[model samples]
Target: MTATARPAEKPAMPHFSSGPCAKRPGWSVEALKGAAVGRSHRAKVGKTKLAQAIDLTRDVLQVPADWRIGIVPASDTGAVEMAMWSLLGERPLDLLAWESFGSGWVTDALKQLKLKDAREIKAGYGKLPDLSAVNFDHDVVFTWNGTTSGVRVPNGDFIPADREGLTICDATSAAFAQRLPFDKLDVVTFSWQKVLGGEAAHGMLILSPRAVERLETYKPAWPLPKIFRLTSGGKLIEGIFKGETINTPSMLAVEDYIDALQWAKSVGGLDGLVARADANTKAIADFVAKVDFLDFLAEVPETRSNTSVCLTFKDPAVASLDDAGQQAFVKAFTGFLEKEGVAYDIAGYRDAPPGLRIWCGATVETADVEALMPWLAFAFEKTKTEMAQAA
Candidate 1:
């Protein structure tokens, strides 16, 4: 029980990377047996499978019947970029950046898309910008969850129901695990590699009628890449929403996604997913509450993400260290756990403040998360002792 002593048990499964995260329990390559691997994605069977995936997604995620959901290329990044490039310059824009991914959107607006009317409302890694400052009169883009920082918007209460501009949200890390206010959002984007733990290289783009209306009515002053185009002859292309992807897609990945969605429905769908994530976060939060050494990176409890739970050292000795020292400490601490193979990829993002970020997504087992707490305590002490002796 001593701080220097290693825990007797290890997490049964320690695959806790934040993205391309742990697979659904009992998952295997066998699940993709029905994949239309040899045939073209346009074939009858391939297209039917793709359409079934879209239908199952709607069933499991409980997306509205009126919204258009499509499987897009390039994961969440592609979906966001498509939305930004297609719809943003029509009005002034508000870009919110509180973490690495959110900041990337800011760069896109200011640097890549080069929208002169874009305004960046930003906060540090652990906090969120003032919601009151958002100019809803203009188009707004933000991440529903800050995967890199372990923070999320508490809810959609801050957004008005009658907003004048479209709200484009990157919910890659939050979808299925959080209750999104779809009625308030014009566009929502996510990837299968996140909460449900499906394969990567694909993105899900969901658009409300307003977003589609904008796409059909307005053309950006700049050229549109074929990959990002959502319209043809000034009409919203209906085929894409029905599983006709812009380019060739990995049918194997689509099959895997369908399998995951089926699993989701079996477990009570979105509500079940959210419950699993909440339980996983509580396991870590309970440990943090009792320990003086660790604390959540998100300053506000409400804003703390249940899925990507981030932590920072609260002990004065570690907290007072410079950024480089803190990173070194984390390296050594995570090294011990990684060497044990009890935890991997739990280090804070390189662009974020020095801290630990753990994935508490639905696919991750809560029991495994509970098993990791003691190891975290042990590793922290072990690293501090070794570093002190070396110093």
Candidate 2:
């Protein structure tokens, strides 16, 4: 008698981690294998491909003609640091903090650079610090989207056009998924591992004309590292933005980024990408509306993010559980989904209140997310059962 074979396990549900988020459906290993590897990034072929990537990005994003784009060392963090270290001392500064990444910038300003006069406006996770109180007369720094908290500045209309201060925006998770008004921005930085869904380890720095002027005329008192140097002897190194990277890059990663950009262009550019992200957010929104135990972390609809959507349990029934018990329930629920191959990495950030943080970026499909909702209900039921047994 032949033994019966075991049933095949279902493939894992689409991953929703905020950083290094899901890739486009149908992305393949064969395409990645074709990427240039073990090749000198300074070679003519490498430079040519890099230039093409920049040009394609400009066209797709509809970047202004005068703006410059550079491939800088480090991910988004490195790119932001380069701008802060190089251009901040020219004027008084206003730093805004609502979440972890924003808080990191404030720390750099206070402790690392030791800028005494900088004004800091901060709020806890899941909320935005008041933007109305900001004095635009001082150099302004903020994240276009708070990846950790799922709050984002809705638009650039809040920025005064005639304001004398330059605006620096950290837009790593927002670049491909949201509408960014370049006219109101001075320095913008992002990385490939975000909405674009490519390799990490490199950052893109986009500079407006006003930012270039600052580099040429105003010099910071701080020492410039080779990676952050944008000028030499009061003259701008214009070629760096045209694909002459400051140091060696991973050519394979460059090619992977190019593949993602090409995919972006093929999918109808920025508008199409934004629509995909919006649909994913809507999926989560609909689910939250019907679930009595869940609610969005973002207090206002206008401020809700289309990319990272965070959720928290709101049922008073669960409130009876102590903090440790609540955490244990969350862990057990997420753990059940992982074992069932329904989702991965849905845990909240350590610094934030206990909840789930899901990436609804462009690369994630709404259908996959829809399929996982029932599984979430199943997991939650399992948690309640486990908790009662423990009690």
Quote each prediction's TM-score: 0.99, 0.95
Against the true structure, candidate 1 reaches a TM-score of 0.99
After superposing candidate 1 on the true structure, give the runs of residues whose Cα lies further than 4 Å from its correct spot: 1-4
User: Over the stretch 234-257, how does candidate 2's per-residue lDDT look in tens digits?
Assistant: 988987888899998887778888
lDDT per model vs. reference = 0.93, 0.85
lDDT of 1 by residue, 159-219 (tens): 9988989999999999999999899899999999999999999999999999999999898
Candidate 1 residue 201 Cα shift, in angstroms, is: 0.6
Please, what's the RMSD in Å of model 1?
1.0
Q: Tell me which residue pairs clash in candidate 2.
A: none
Query: For all candidates, what are the clash counts?
Result: 0, 0
In candidate 2, which residue ranges exceed 4 Å CA deviation? 1-13, 320-322
lDDT of 1 at 92: 94
